[model samples]
Target: MNVLVIGKGGREHALVQKLSESPMVDELYAAPGNAGITEATCVDIVETDIDGLIALVHSKDIGMTIVGPEAPLELGIADRFHEAGLKVFAPTQKAALLEGSKSYAKAFMQRHEIPSAAYATFSDPEAAKDYIQAQGVPIVVKADGLAAGKGVVVAETTEEAIEAVDDMLVNKRFADAGATVVIEEFMEGKEFSLMAFVNGKDVYPMITARDHKRAYNQDKGPNTGGMGGYAPVPDVSAEDLTFSYEHILQKTADGLIAEGRSFTGVLYAGLMMTQEGPKVIEFNTRFGDPETQIILPLMKNDLLQVFEDVLAGKDPELEWEDQASVGVVLAANGYPEAYKKGMPIPQINGNVYTAYAGVAGTDEQLVANGGRVLLVGAKNDTAPEAAKTVYQALKQIDNNTDYFYRTDIGL
Candidate 1:
């Protein structure tokens, strides 16, 4: 069957690459794909262009469509496809509120009794500011709507928290997305990502992955989608994984079903291993970006089959390689802020796999086009070994000073 993968980032590139390896997929196509996705035919339709995408799917006879990002899902692309009798691997718009609206997710968690930090939603700037002042220092202020993973501010002081509230609710930093905000007490712990393929209440968890959200090393700097990630995190014990599945993932799935929104597709739990156990920091309705880059390489099962089985509501037998994989994102200079683009990227020669997040021009002459340029992934017997191999491959790229990547990945 021919498969079409949506989105135009590193996660989409990784999905395209993985799906290309499936024997069930005779042909693969990507919408607005980047330069690193050489394994499939790239289409010109933007991910959010539902009508354009539907036309492309019919024109190409795409048997199944898989969405890679949250934006298209929030735009109800899956609903549109279903309305046309097309098969798509994504949750519906009503279900996508798990990621689209912070306040909604917080309330959902509360209703389900899911373990998460206590938070309060506010629309008035003064009310939010007052809540912040009462909550004291070291709080988390989040825009109620999507902000490309940068709408959250982890403030360390009352002044910082108030400033963040004003920026979101008063100053309109994120516009309507920030008109309402969710402020919660900051939880201190190590965070990890747990993604699962879901078909209603049947959830199949993938290998654990820990992503470096901060831009610079040692977990310092502003978050920029993700800087790097590694799969099968060694520190996350098997017992903890089981607990997360029973208390968090399963409950979340059941809660969504009870709420009359049966979620199908990826359910990503951004969990923090606090003193109270694994508590959710946030939830994403689709695959995590750099985390997908690392996790897909370790998946031994056919991804196409997995998607088909989930859509059919059948239990899919998933398998993963024991090997560890690490991915490091190479971003443009001054990333998470203003940065230059179109810088020529010299060819990299190594065994590493490259997934393009942002680039322009043809494959033969690629140039940086976004904040995160590309991700290089490597697999080995251990996480550290994989990180070493990935970093070694990164050194082969020219103009190393022009791009920045976290050096402490998998350490």
Candidate 2:
């Protein structure tokens, strides 16, 4: 079957790479793919170009199209493709609202009795400020709509919370995405990502992964999608994983079905392990960037087969490797903010995998083209061992100085 994977990032790159390895896939393609996705033929249609994409799918006789990012799903690409009589693996727009709107997700969690932080939504800046002040310090401020991954701000002070409110509601930093805000009490605990292949109420959870959202070392600096991550997190106990699967991921799938917004595709829960149990911090309707790069490699089952079986309402009986996988992002020098691009990507040597997130050109001509340039990952019997091997490969690019990556991944 000819398959087309949408989006242009590390996540899409991983999907393309994995799908290409499937014998069920006769021809593989990626829309607007980055430089590192050599396994699939890259298409030029942008993810938001619904008409163009539909036409391309028909023209190429693509059997299945997998949506990789939230933007196109929020734009109802799946709905459009279905309308055009095409097979698309993604949730409808209404179902994708769980990730597209923070306020909507908060309300849904409340309605479904799912565990999450207590939050209040506001459109007025003054009202938001007042609430932040009353809530005291250490709160979370989030833009109601998608802002890439920078909409969230964990404010430790009332002043900082107010500032974030002003930025979203007053300064319009995130544009329309920030017009409304959801302020929540900061839940204290370690964070982990649990992604599952979801088809309506049927959910198959993947291995747990811990993503380092902070840009700099020791958890400092602003978040930039994700800086690094490791799968099969050692610190997360098996009991906790079971609790998260049942209370969080499973409940969410059932809730979406009951709400008349049945979801299909990757459902990612950004969760925190509180003293009480696992609670959702946020949700993503598509595969996570750094997390996908690390976790997908650990899956023993064929990627296309999993998607097909899930779509058919059949159990894929997914299996994963016993080895641990760690991935680190190589971002532009001053990432999570403004930075330069087009710096030549150095040749990576060693037994490691590379998922190009942001680059242009091909082969030796590849150059950094976005904030997060690429991800370097490795698999080993232990997380520490994988991290060591990945970091050693990254040292090969350190001399360029135009890119930077976290030094403490999987520590």
Candidate 3:
């Protein structure tokens, strides 16, 4: 069957590559896909144009539409596809509120007794500032709406907290996304990514991954989409994984179902392994970027079949290789900020798998087209070995100074 994968990033590239390997798939297509995904036919439809996407689905006879990014999912693309009698692998708009609106997610977590940091929502800048002053320093201020994963600010001082509040509410840093803010106490711990396939209350957890969100090394600098990641994080024990599935993942799916919005797509939980236990920092309704780049390589199951089974409300059998995978994102210089693009790229070689996030040029040559250019992933028996393989291949790309990647990934 023909499969349509949405979005134009490393995540979609990974999905396309995996789906292309499926014997059940006759053809694969990607909407606005990147340059490295040569395995699939790239389409011209933008992700947010739901009508255009629906029309394309019908025109291409796409048997299943697998969404990659959160924006399109939050825009109700799946709902529209369902209305048109098309099978789509994504959550409905109502269910996407788990990621679209921070306040709503926090409220839902609280209502369902899901373990998460205590937070309060505020719209007024003055009111928010007053609350921050009372709450003390070292807090997390988040834009209630999406801001391309940069809407959150972790303040270490009361002054910084107030300033962030003003930046969001008064200066409109994130624009409409910052109109309302959710401030929560900062929890200290190692962070891990747990993604699961969900259909109503059936939640199947995948291998755990930990992504570096900070731009520079040593967790310094501002946050970017993601710098690097590795799967089956060593610190996250099997017990922790079981706790996440039973207490967080399952409860979340049940809560959504009870609210009359049964989710039917990837449910990603950004968790912090605190001293007390694992607590959710945030929830994403779709697959994560760099994490997907690493995890997909270790998946031993056919991705297309998994999507079909999940959509049919049948528990999909997922298998993963007993190997660790690491992915390092090579971003354009000055990434997560103003950066140059259109720089020529050399050939990538070795055992590394390159998932392009941004690039534009003819087949003969490729150039950086966005902040994050591509992700180079490698698989091995251990995380350190995988990281070594990835970095060794990354070193082969000539003129390394043009792009920046976190060196501490998987260390």
Q: What's the TM-score of every candidate structure?
A: 0.98, 0.99, 0.98
User: Which tens-of-lDDT digit does each residue in 29-112 have in candidate 1?
Assistant: 999887767889998899889999999999999999999888898899889999999999999999999999999999999999
Per-residue error at 269 for model 1, in Å?
0.3
Q: Which is the leading candidate under TM-score?
A: 2
| Model 3, position 366: C-alpha lDDT score | 91
Error of 2 at 326 (Å): 0.4
Candidate 1, poorest ten consecutive residues by summed lDDT? 393-402
Q: Per-residue alpha-carbon lDDT of model 3 for 307-348, expressed as tens digits?
A: 988878787889999999989888999999899998986577
RMSD (Cα, Å) of candidate 3?
A: 1.1
> How well does model 1 score by local distance difference test?
0.90
- What total of clashing residue pairs does each candidate reach? 0, 0, 0
Whichever of 1 and 2 has more TM-score, that candidate is 2
Worst 10 residues of 3 by lDDT: 393-402
| Local distance difference test, each candidate | 0.90, 0.92, 0.91
Candidate 3 residue-wise lDDT at 371: 91
